[model samples]
Target: MSLRIEQVGPASSARLAAIHATGFDRPWPANEIASLLHMPASLALAAYDGDEMGGFVLVRSAVDEAEILTIAVHPDLRRSGAGRALLDAMADVLVRTGVTRVFLEVSTANTAARALYDRAGFRQIGQRHGYYADGTDALVLEKTLQGSGQDGA
Candidate 1:
């Protein structure tokens, strides 16, 4: 599949919300995502296969830190790298903004998501009990960015 990541704009909110609802139980309302785009220090990206929206990621930046608000792949496209593509795109944005670390909270029951985060170099930091509206626990994960110097030329 030819997947491409594009920054999501207010006009895409309706489609973005539909993708989110299809992928997860707790989906953001269209207006919620639309509002995020107008916020300073926030970035939202949507992954697409041609004209079809496949996945998306929302993130917020603060100083040297960034936090992922949401990441979801369309149910039919899960395990097809759409999620990873969206994630990598967001990471690129964070790196460009000088973010030294990024964090996110995922449902404990989302093993697939956890595995993806693990492969992306995220380390589990802690857990929040009953963090979800459905009473699911959340696992907090963090990835520290390596300085350019640390990458070794």
Candidate 2:
């Protein structure tokens, strides 16, 4: 069960979309993922198990702040450390890029995702009512980077 995390470029959009579709009820299309990856301020990290994509995390950075666009793990691979590896890779990139804070939104009903974010040091910062298609409120979580010393100026 060797897992490797890699920074994914636009060429890997289809693979990212496939894994995302398997993990979520609604997934972004490959073209959309490619467009996001083409953005200079955005990045995507993928966790691969041998030849298969296990999970991914997409992020957009602006100055010292960054937002997690989305994160997902293959349904069959959840709780197998893929999610955590993707997140750890994401944080490593953020720190290296001088991002000092990161934000994400999770459905209040998605206890698994909330637990993952909580374990990654993110705390509830705000909320949005009826933020999801199913009317589930979204909990906004934020984590501030510590000791990186990069101002992101």
Candidate 3:
């Protein structure tokens, strides 16, 4: 459980793209990941087990709120706490960046992800029917960070 979560840059886009492909039906390409890395207020983090990539999360901020654009943990690393580590680190970074609230969408059928979000203190705020390409419903969740607007100490 020695997962090290670090902020990532565009140079890791290709690696992130590769890791993303493992969990996504339509994973983003390296160029697209690079584009996101360059966007204003966008940030990405990678969780590593020593030198091995465990997962990654990408988010974008607007005013006092942030949206998780995407998050992926390698199938082999699922349930190994990598996902939770990534989420905790994301919140810390957001709080320092003045992001007070965070939002994300998870498939209604994704019990694993839903459980994680629930344990992380996110609440269901909305739903989008047939939001996925496979016609699965998506549940929108939100969490407000405590002690937000702090310096990135």
Candidate 4:
């Protein structure tokens, strides 16, 4: 089914946390998700199939840069386009805010997620060892906004 993307609001935190719990190896607590609402320049977009949240992407923007704090899709609904839709929605929001680039780190073992970021034009710029609680390294990926990159690629 097609999903609708919404800008996450105060009432959406519980649902976003639920989606994250269902998708992650170690999920953030509901309160932690709620706290994001208070962070300056933070924005979240949630994807819904009817009344149910299917995925979400959280971004924190500053100056010319933005970082994707999290992106998660319900396990059963993955491999569909929900994740990409959420990312695109967040990117659009960032663009309007004058963000010139975005960065995020993905667990090295999350091949599917890495593939999605790569397909969306993100390139690995570096890595962090033992970045996850389980000791998995994280690959830092970055994507420049169109017309914002120095190389203009």
Q: What is the model-wide C-alpha lDDT for candidate 3?
A: 0.89
In model 2, which residue pairs have backbone atoms overlapping below 3 Å?
none
TM-score of each: 0.92, 0.93, 0.93, 0.93
Per-residue lDDT, model 2, residue 151, is 22
Off by over 4 Å in 3: 148-153
Candidate 4 segments exceeding 4 Å error: 147-152
TM-score of 1: 0.92
**Candidate 4 or 1, higher TM-score:** 4
lDDT at 39, model 2: 97
Which residue pairs clash in candidate 3?
A: none
Q: Write the per-residue lDDT of candidate 3 for residues 1-153, one digit (tens) a residue.
A: 688999998999999999999988889999999999999889999999889987999999999999998999998799998888888889998888778889999999889999988887888999999999999999999998877422222
Model 4 reaches what TM-score against the true structure?
Answer: 0.93
Output the number of the lDDT-best candidate: 3
The TM-score, computed over Cα atoms with residue i paired to residue i, of candidate 3 is: 0.93
lDDT of 4 by residue, 23-120 (tens): 78789877888888678788889888888888999888899899999999998789899988887777777777788899999999999999999877
| Candidate 2 TM-score versus the reference | 0.93
lDDT of 1 by residue, 27-97 (tens): 89999998997789888898888888888898889999989998878887899988877777777777778
Clashing pairs in 1: none
- Cα RMSD for predicted model 1: 2.6
- Per-residue alpha-carbon lDDT of candidate 2 for residues 76-144, written as tens digits (9 for 90 to 100): 789998898788778878888888899999999999999988887888899999999999999999888
